[model samples]
Target chain A: MNDRTTVSPSARTTIRRLPELANHDRAMLYSIVDEAYVCHIAFAANQDTHCIPTAHWRKDDYLYIHGSNGSRLIKALSAGAQASVAVTLLDGLVLAKSAFSHSMNYRSTVVYGQFEVVQDSAEKLAALDVFMDKIAAGRNHEARPGNSKEINATSVLRISLAEAAVKVSDSLPSDKDEDLDLAVWTGILPLKTTRGMPIHAESGEHIAVPDYVKNWAD
Target chain B: MNDRTTVSPSARTTIRRLPELANHDRAMLYSIVDEAYVCHIAFAANQDTHCIPTAHWRKDDYLYIHGSNGSRLIKALSAGAQASVAVTLLDGLVLAKSAFSHSMNYRSTVVYGQFEVVQDSAEKLAALDVFMDKIAAGRNHEARPGNSKEINATSVLRISLAEAAVKVSDSLPSDKDEDLDLAVWTGILPLKTTRGMPIHAESGEHIAVPDYVKNWAD
Candidate 1:
């Protein structure tokens, strides 16, 4: 973890709507990015704006994503196109007495910057290992490591997390004073992403379940 | 539901990477949009691209979103700016014997279009009702409806779902023949968004829990 405690929002990263929900603490940004399995990235290509979802991982103060060398997203970002990435985790639904006051509880972060291509082979391999570790701890060492040919076919890119904005809404329902006395049911309906029992592949059923898989649902 | 069976993919909506994983079925597109609580919208404004997450809902052939009239997203899209919207649902992590073969099972859809503002007051109100129903079936009737002033402050915009692409990845792990004998525990680790117990607001604890809240987790 870095010693930085806060992020300096860029012109585009500043939150204008409901600024009270904006958070600047660097740890909050890291946690939001770390907990999410995928992030939606927006970039312009061929004079068109595109939003695409892909797996993401964090290493130090940078967010990393990998894709085939010929992919449109990789080609566009590697060319130094300005991009915005968003990761949102819906925590719950806040039902207020007033329809206009209804809201959602969520933790979301948006990062703005140009992606830099990871050109060094060693750095690229280490980054991929970090991504694999994110998927399943200790499995990276056990799985067949990527061969030169496989690694060569992929392109890894990283963007700094300095210019980012975090917004978290975890409060209970807040209705207008006049609507508070209404007889409608007001509450929070919590939502969480949970893991289910692991299913072993047909060829690997004889292998023992790893600690990561065993503790996944817990 | 409309009788439309498929979406005609435009040049921008065509899935070039992993084309076989793409589905043109209109029902698949609707199901993906209907099941998602939020979508990431990508649009270019002020010479920079932005990807932001916002609550969304579908009614008939259009996906709708509402925001404060002054919000950046609402303003940018209402100006006829081209946009791309993506909704992604991650189902599981696919672990394979080889690190390079690791994949994710997901249902994702991307729509490319320009959002048009809902000008009619009655139409906007009815669209918001559909959104409320998605949050809770009968809560719209019980909650204090939005007054004229509140309704006027909100901007509702809808984008046609005709130019959309659906991609569903539900296959098992597939590793190379040479790596099949590897001893790694390969399988699927499922992930699902689940509802937790309802939490009543302090002022409304006396009210009975609605059936939607009661059956949320089930």
Candidate 2:
């Protein structure tokens, strides 16, 4: 099922000339999403499209995203439906003489499908657990479970793996022969995003950070 | 033009509250876009949608984004068609006890509308100037004008400001009263993306860095 046709069977996708990477590169796709602690979610709403930048986690072939009940995204897809989600990481910058040739090094993935709220009490509980573990494994069991009100007020969405693909670009741009001597500085500005020290809340609070929190990345 | 309407606007779309960032707070939108140099461009194609991460620069109300003439995006939105473009900057990470509460701080702008390639030679030249100025202020004048082939091969899209908004979140997760004693870290992990030194390429030749390059960022 994880074939090029299964994901983007359209002529619109142009991954043919790009070597070292393919549209169906599962490892690359997973790595980009896994390395990122957040994803940008976009969808069409009111004939106008809306893009929401949100934190998300992936488990197996599905994505588990949630937010407070008041969030528009929660309400949009929670009412028995689905939408689209995308995650990406900028690897580096591509500088060239021609402004039009400037590009970026990055790995990105897009998943399109329907998403619905986790309904069955057990499944919903499991989904919630998966999300918790996905973020910080053992921490799921260490922290206080959401009170009934908190559970009821928040919404969790489960979007099964739909059509998706990974696109990666890591090339330093190529400049024309004559234009190459323009004397302009034109090289990459490498970029990396990583999680920093986990600061404790200011308020008087006390709890041990589970080992899972220490190992969690991506 | 930007107002809230609660209705299933289209079959593929349902209104969602994505931070309500566009509600009269328009200047915040421009500032966020200006600070970000890269954006993830997404669109609905085939049976599923796709998101392509690329570099982008803005001028006034319009954003000029381009790629290889063979790019999937260039093919999809050629000559006066609409598309969705988004730029985001991840500022920090939000750590909370509950895995579900884990989040990030970011500023992102999502814009939707039509785009048309600068088909006219004069228009393409103007866009090329804008492109250079956006990256290196006054370098476009010093560089040679793009010929027909160079101009013809690349696709330059002009996105209107009709539908767009900036959604931001910088809050530390709400540390609960009881969970306060849990002792787990619950604060932010700051992030910063900066421009690095530029790399210039010549015919196995090294040319002195021009004032244009030296003062590029100055």
Candidate 3:
């Protein structure tokens, strides 16, 4: 399933301007989305558009994003609006030989699709599990599951990754031959997302941080 | 000019859901934009909408984003379409007491405005400087500036931060009293963006790494 053929890009998903940087591999797109902790979802709020940053998790071909049931964007999505989701993982800073060529090395996926509100209680409950387990393995069992009351108050929208585009620039800075002779330093300063020592909450003082939290470095 | 009064949120920019976490402080918004290395910009492409991850920098009242002249999103913005720019700084993970409350600590800024294409050569050059200097101080001068040809090949869009909103969730996970007694560990796992050692490019073998690069911990 993780093949370029599975991710057939339409006119919207096609990377036309800089086609060289576009990757058609489905696995690459999945990896970028999976590794990212947040996604910026753009949905039409009346005539105007609003892009919101929210936590997201992926299950198979669908990307699940949850928010308060009262959110304007969530309401719009739940009402069946085409949403554009962008997840970008910044890998490093590319110091090019020239200022114009300077850029960032990032793996970004843009998925354009209509969101389907997961209404079934069973599916919604399972979707909540995907959120926790995706972030940290075994977190679903460790934490108390969401009760029906709490689950009903939250809204989950699922966007299929079937129509998505992945753009990545993971290489070293490419410099012009003329600029190579310049005395300026050219290279990449890799950026990494790291987890610091977990801080126990006021109510969590007695419980020990599980192995999942300790080894949770995404 | 960096006052909440300047960043007056309009109806479209207001946060109706979870309004308590919304911040109107302009400085907080500026700091979030300044600290972020990349931003996701959404623009319309005929019947389709595209959200792209691109490098962005902020000046006093304007947020500047540049892209290839041939890019569809850049062209759309230049053609006076309303652009939605979202900059998100993920700070940590909030492991709530229950799955329903699982959230992320992030400072996100969403700006809604019609981008004005920067036409002046002098202003475009200065904007490029802001891109590098904002990310790494003093590196703009060290590298060669964009020549007229390069400048002409790039399309720069400036969006005012006037109609903008900043949403932040920085608090620890809040769980219900009933769930607190569960054996699960609940707390915050802080996420930090750190820079690793600078890697020299093929042409930068002999040049000493500059102080600006060494001290460049964003």
Candidate 4:
């Protein structure tokens, strides 16, 4: 159902400043969510707003998040609190000729909606499997699945990706005509999220390293 | 000063779940903020809550952020809207024997406060220099400084780090005794933000590369 490509679904979602950086493609929104392992969710409760980071994954047109049943985030979100979720990937630092022109290259997406509690047990289990698969492909089949009690104590919630905005700034540094002629080094110092060598747990030393672990750093 | 080591200075900042993972060290809180380039801010405006990502820099015990004077974030925060800011660094994924035990190793901090606008022109310029130093040391002196008109069009704001909560999860993956005996490879796939090669802007190719850009990826 991601064929819908229009963005800025509402007044608040519209990008008022630097509107050129706004991306209208649905795939752009999906890619931003898929690439990020964590997202910050903003919601209000008890006259205070909170921005909390948590693991997230996406399936179809819904972005899913799970938390302990007793968590304040879960308690407020499940009670129909409006939520704003943001995922950002910093790509590089753009060094412009002028201090005011210096900027960062990043890809970010924001979703605005009310999170719906995923009440169906079967759907919840499927969503959890999707999350596990994201962490490590084929991991759901290898690991022991969550028990009934464990499932009951966790709350799964999803927000529709229909109302979202994506912004991407990946271009090279730009400077004013006068500043460009100045003797200054200008370019992009790229930044990337890369995987490092795996660290095996002591208890799993006897087990063979899976393909996911082997290819992690590659 | 940062000598105050107490964390969770307010009731809402308390970590109720997995309280053992809560950190009380002020140094830990400062490190978390210092290491991150961006943070998500939660604020209410026009009856809608927003989670926005922006660049941040820490000076003394305050976290500073800047934007154009016309931006909504600058307008809302400068007017004394309450804010909840969160910075998170994901270290790795903890793959355990059981799906339910899977977790992530991360250091996260949340600060609750109202931002105070930087009114003094000299103070604002000094803060911007501090931000430049974080991006690339010695580059502030090399680049063309912001002129009076440019400085007048920007707004800088800072929030105190006094009321904050720090949560750190950096440990080997653990599983239930019964699940630990299963033939599964469990460990951490570490994630790191690394710098890549610098790409020179076409207009600045004649300029010599500075020491910062030369050693960026090193």
Candidate 5:
């Protein structure tokens, strides 16, 4: 059963040093998760831990991550091992007055839960649709439909966002009083992820760029 | 002692499912590690796993990660729990004819090791300088120097890139013959992280943007 408990900062998720930056608002959690296309899924296997980066998407309350049925991590997760998923969007470089104070402005979310494999064919299809649309609008309909073999060969794991933690560090760089007069430039060098000009595939060169793909931006 | 063993596909670092895409070349590993600014660190703490995103920089064969001395993860690492650090750079989106064939073009590296605290003040200061230049060139010399207290307050964990896994996926989308003729746009929507115009702090607005920060790019 999916846990629907309200997310409270447990000893695990609490931001100890900078407690003010911890956020538990549901909207903020959803926004941070929605703004990214990739996540790192970490799990313990063979007496060691590994974090695998993969594509991810969010629906109402569940975060869906799909991978090949043969993936070891997928098999391990399906066996009920708890997984930790993290998504991070680096916003900018915070340049402070002192080297010790330099930091990055970023928004990140960490979700910890046991993933249940989506076995129902219909649910799997719907999850696939959500994944495609999350990556690009109108992509599922535009692309060839998923066949039964394809659906069966894929493993879709669903995790509830009930025990999630969201942390945001967007404050301007602060300096010590004594360092303020130092002859250094102090400001933010904002970093942005932008969509560049599309490059057509070998056979797709003659195909016109679809408006959905052309106008897509993060 | 830092582990200098050759990077092999051990049980933890092996790319089992997609073995063809695995890369272990030292130069390729260094290149992938050098190109990114942020990494997601995953570790098991308090019976739950957490993957926190933080800025990272590589020097020679060691990867340095610093955080507040009171951070739970840092404390756990110092106490001798191994960490799994993953850095992913999204190069483009692969739009394919079939949903199952769609994938992202990216370069990522995963390093697994226990971190040792850099207790020597000189080594710690030099590591901090390397970090500053990695983020923004000339940032360290331009900024106010770190005092002894500040140096003591920070925890810099050094992990040798001994057992690491690097994966680069730059392939164009390939689909089944029947699905290739589908009327879908098949191409790459390249994603790039670029620097935006600098925004100065309140008192630093009058200072000219330095050439080092101005030319910084990832």
Candidate 6:
């Protein structure tokens, strides 16, 4: 049997159960990770645990998680040498008249794997390039390269998509007949989270928006 | 020790971990559920697994989950009679030079509990009201009530916050002695997710904009 997991809550909205919901395949993996700007990563560290939501970009079957050497997520994975990463995207809200009838539609993923630090000089350079391209599409070559000082302090953790799942729920509310006439209003109030136009960093003085930056997805 | 359940992909972002990471205390539970608008629920049914994301709201001690009578979540929980739920909020992105050194700052919670259909008619009504006020901040009284027909078609499930854990991480990248001077753009691209303006939902045309609606929270 597949080692299936469950996400239960005091509310049913948090517990999604669609058959088409769990996407463990490769194609679905890339699509889910590429569309969003932010992802909430849940990882196990020490005897304790933590979930860190941060900016991320995917390259093939590997997801790159970054942090200062001081950050908990990085420290946990680097020290314990094993981790679980999860990312979710919220699309919109689904409303139903009965208080118990409201819900939302969204896309989410959770990955389990042992992360390995990138150390090879050329491989490290490639990993950095992929990260830039994944986040900004083509910004890697267009933007200035990181100086030696900046590269030394940064750390990147790579989680191979060895075991994972993609789950999505997209349906309007289904209210009942008797409760229909109750005074509460019901309908979807959709929510979309996206990045705004590139606001050149203050340090980007005089540098025109690179074509790579302009071409990045929303 | 609290019961430890596995959170699989079938339920979306729901994950299972040790007791330390899966706490269900008062202060720990309220903040995680309160601060989030959506959640990832994991469950199992027909001997398979799944997880999905949906909107949610909370009551005093119990959380209210609404869905179509045919929802996969309700179907599974009502069957196996239990599940897991998780919500995570992404705060920012930490970009570092090395691919493995990147990370993020965020807060998240995982709750494991048995799911029961809210059978009490009176309590279901109250739960719906709380949901309305929670979202629109007083729109419940202003909006029209639901007819009986609406309530009958939807299913509401209730689960206790008997077990859960909350984790939050925030930190910046380190400009190591060598990588610090790489000239590449370095630093965090801060991120925040919040509710936007009141759409003055078409149904609310008669109500006009109430002060509560005008001053909503993030």
Q: Which candidate is the best by DockQ?
A: 4
Candidate 4 residue runs with Cα over 4 Å from true position: A1-3, A203-206, B1-8, B203-205
- lDDT string for model 1 (B1-218, tens) is 22488877788888899998999788889999999999999999898899999999999999999999999999999999999999999999999989999999999999998999999999999999999999999898899999999999999999999888889999889999999887888889999998999887764456777899888773
Cα miss at B114, model 4 (Å)? 0.3
RMSD in Å for candidate 4, one decimal?
1.6
Q: Is the docking of candidate 2 incorrect, acceptable, medium or high quality?
A: acceptable
For each model in turn, which proportion of the native inter-chain contacts is also found?
Answer: 0.89, 0.32, 0.75, 0.89, 0.78, 0.06
| DockQ ranking from best candidate downward | 4, 1, 3, 5, 2, 6
lDDT of each structure?
Answer: 0.92, 0.63, 0.83, 0.92, 0.82, 0.58
Per-residue C-alpha lDDT of model 2 across residues A1-218, encoded as one tens digit per residue = 55523444234343554635555655666666677767766565455445566767667777777788887667766764335677877766666776556666777776766777776666766777766665556656666677777777777786765566567787777778877767555666566665555554564535455454454433
For A1-218, candidate 5 gives per-residue lDDT tens digits of: 22343457755566676778887777778887888889998888777777778888998888898988888778888998878899888889899888888888888888887999999999889888988887787777678787888888899999988778788889788898988877778888888888888777755465667787768655
Give per-residue lDDT, candidate 1, residue B82: 96
Q: Of the pair 4 and 6, which is ahead by lDDT? A: 4
**Tens digit of per-residue lDDT, candidate 2, span B96-165:** 7665456667777677767767677787678767766666567675555667787787777778554665
Q: Model 3, stretches more than 4 Å misplaced?
A: A1-6, A203-206, B1-6, B203-206
Give the higher-TM-score candidate: 2 or 4: 4
lDDT of 1: 0.92
Candidate 3 reference-contact recovery: 0.75
Report the Cα lDDT for residue B32, model 1.
Answer: 93
TM-score of chain B of each: 0.96, 0.78, 0.92, 0.96, 0.91, 0.77
Name model 1 segments beyond 4 Å from true: A1-3, A203-205, B1-3, B203-206
Can you give the TM-score per candidate against the true fold?
Answer: 0.97, 0.77, 0.94, 0.97, 0.93, 0.59
Worst 10 residues of 2 chain B by lDDT: B5-14
DockQ, per model, reads 0.85, 0.32, 0.71, 0.87, 0.69, 0.10
